[model samples]
Target: MSTSWRDRFEKNFISPEKKLGLDEILEEAHDAYLGWLAASLTAFHSDFNEDQVDQLDRIFQGESRIRSIANDCYNYAINGRFRLAKDAQEQEQMNDDWVCLAILVQSARPGIEEFSLTVRGRPIGVPAKLEQLLFHAQIRALLDFSTVDGFDEESVSVPQFFSQPVPGYLTLKEIALLGQMSERAVRNAAQPAAADRLQTRKEQTQTVVDATEALRWLKGRRGFIATRAD
Candidate 1:
């Protein structure tokens, strides 16, 4: 049988046979979990590429909960108490992360979608794509609880542009996509009279935002991830 995520995690992270210490286990949890998730993706699709794996690593590394829970799971398992209720909760969430990962795989391997559907229950609320989930998670992580105010249809729109290597000189539409804002909102923000106006310039007839200003503007917006360091 293929090794399950639980089994893989225990073998590599818990390392019960080797009797590693808590600090040792926690120190390697992030990278170990990255490999564990990559292995999970490989289980679903053999053709999964490095770029996709790197993207997955980046997404979950930025997500603190993943490493925290992996460390907790390791800590509890070290004491031979692997079946705690909290570990059960963590496992359930990990399953959801795997499902989200399957969505990422779906573009390259469409058949994975059918497999994902088999495992998923009927949607309980508004359905979200993986990008939206990551965006919202970033918001919750970086900002105060009270600052995360409201959501609308646009709020759930994928920040697809944020995934690029560098967000150099974005167009109005690109800025809109990156910020999950409507074109009208992005356009208004670029105007000279607008409050906190973006540093924009006309390239031929169309206006574009400088990457530096773009980052500054996005820092204040909800669901923005600084993929590139300033």
Candidate 2:
């Protein structure tokens, strides 16, 4: 087996044709990480209602840890940190790097270290519910989210669309982020001067769009997936 993290990751995690420049790769990785988190919630909390899962999904976006992890892991592999795994221990360490990234990204809170199954650096008799949830979710994320053979049925796949709940009203920034477009683009589209302009209303100093109008405008655009609230 190849010991190099970069080589192993390239061979296992992504399809050859899907590889791109660093920036593009990182962008896709970030999107994929968030998508996975959102999609995986149901598996982690099967008994939880849709509202519960939606609430948890919102919590996942509270911190940008997943984006940070994607960048850090990409940089680690690209910056010559990946070494040839010559022995069992070395190979395990290489695997841990990926696992660590998965674990950290699963944190709903700002500081992942706070989720450590410990207090003041000391182990506890029983881990807290949140701690256990994050721990197991990370393991499942690595195993199921990866393109590795045996672990996943699909050898190659694209990031699937994950729906986020939309509020009755959204700021231009929120619309841009939710729609996977730029704020500039959203602003331009919302401008009165634009043809087929998106309808908007002002809230204090900020401009906001009605969710129904936003979706109507967005639905006509290429690659725009509709989001709903229950």
User: Can you give the TM-score per candidate against the true fold?
Assistant: 0.34, 0.32
On residues 1-230, what C-alpha lDDT tens digit does candidate 2 reach at each position? Answer: 11352243333332211222346544444444433443454345533344653466577652255445445444322221212344456545545544545443333222222322222233322112222222222222232222222222231121111112223566675455334456788889877799879899988887887666765776676534432111
Best by lDDT: 1
**Model 2, which residues run further than 4 Å from truth?**
1-167, 227-230
10 residues in a row with least lDDT, candidate 2: 155-164
Best by TM-score: 1
Give one digit per residue, the lDDT tens place, for model 1 in 78-168.
Answer: 2212221234455455445434432332232233332332111221111122223232222222221122232111222222211222224
* Model 1 worst lDDT run, 10 consecutive residues: 118-127
After aligning candidate 1 to the native by TM-score, how far in Å is the CA of 171 from where it should be? 2.6
Candidate 2's displacement at residue 29, Å, is 8.7
Clashing pairs in 2: 3-85
Report lDDT (CA) for all predictions: 0.42, 0.41
